[model samples]
Target: MKDKTIDYLLRATWIAVAKMYNEEASKKGSTMATGFALLNIDPEEGTPSTSLGPKMGMEATSLSRTLRSMEDKGLIVRKKNPEDGRSVLIQLTDFGKEMRIFSKQVVLKFDEAVHREINQEDLDTFSRVAQTIMDLINNKKIYKKQIPSK
Candidate 1:
């Protein structure tokens, strides 16, 4: 290819961002996945174990591993949901709350830096483009089955 494609650009940018986040998280002895999960969990009301996977766009197995690590770190506790007998709630401990704050600050700092560097109009266009890509993927419009002519 003579030039990079849209997907390539998006993938490269996201990879860089993920690496940056992981580096920052490592300084505090955490991973980006853990920080992301912490941010997704509700502080006041515990989140449902089943819902956490979907909410964080994580697979059940991966989410389970991360949750287990968090539990081992004494960052979170799993309590049986009083409202539902079959489900459990993932509640953060004081330590989890503290880490969540740190994660939030890291995300906010990145956002602030981007905003300072990019104008609002460019940011808006970038958001719209990203959303459009998401919509296409979510709607399954990008890849459809086609029958071959005999």
Candidate 2:
């Protein structure tokens, strides 16, 4: 098979795995961590909206939309940036903080289970392969560069 075909297979596999997790996660929107990396970010540091996109594997527009939705859900609040009136500052609400904690536990168990199945050498190999995949996605902004790119 061609390299592109292989790449497509890999992409399909990733989508399948993600969908499996998301299906499980749908029960508690954000509680099971369907999109944990995107959701659980650094605590409210008075950060700018534009800056968070690249740091969190997001684009400004998508992040804005997500933030707006989360805002409507009372999970976050956005204020006009004092330093730059043109931009918005984001901070999680009390509800979001609590949810972050709960989602983190789910993430931890997921990580532990995946890690437990692999030995050290294979773990290193897996990390390297995953990083390579991420590098490809990051440089290309593949599929919009949302969350870990892996």
Candidate 3:
């Protein structure tokens, strides 16, 4: 990692985390994207299909495919939104709820492990720094000027 840039470190760390989640998801006969969608969905009330893509930061086509796969796995069902006849709602099945709990536990275990290893002040600073980076990217501040390559 000598001479590595911040962007390089960010990408590497994210890839490692994603790989870990993917491996865990594979053991449960699911994918990380499905688990993420499950976690975002409301347990009691169904989530609107239209909003799922933005909520997951996923493209509509990708989300549609994942939702279809979940439906095929008997993990979820799509119902017409009663409030808005033009919209559809995505609701988790019993099995989906079970998987959601599994996803939650996986996240909690990772969080607990990190918490145990890092001091509160360090963790808080890391959180702030990460959020700052996200905010900068979201606001398009990081790419305002083109970089000169070596």
Structure candidate 2, residue pairs in collision:
none
Model 1, poorest ten-residue lDDT window? 1-10
Top candidate by lDDT: 1
lDDT of 1 by residue, 1-150 (tens): 459999899899999999999999999899999999999999999999999999999999999999999999888999999999899999999999999999999999999999999999999999999999999999889997688889
Which residues of candidate 2, in runs, are more than 4 Å off?
1-5, 31-34, 37-40, 133-150
RMSD per candidate (Å) reads 1.9, 7.4, 3.7
Write model 2 residue lDDT over 1-150, tens digit each, in one string: 465775787789778767766765665674222245335455666467777777676666777777777777777778898999998877777877776666666567767987899888998997899898879777885666458655
Give Cα-based local distance difference scores for all models.
0.96, 0.69, 0.94
Better of 1 and 3 by lDDT: 1
Q: What is the lDDT of residue 133 in candidate 2?
A: 84
Total clashes for model 3: 0
- Estimated TM-score for each candidate: 0.95, 0.71, 0.92
Which digits, one per residue and each the tens of the lDDT, describe model 3 over residues 11-92? 9999998999999999999988999999999988989999888989999899999999999999999999999999999999
What does the lDDT read for residue 97 in candidate 1?
98
Q: Which stretches of candidate 3 lie over 4 Å from their true place?
A: 145-150
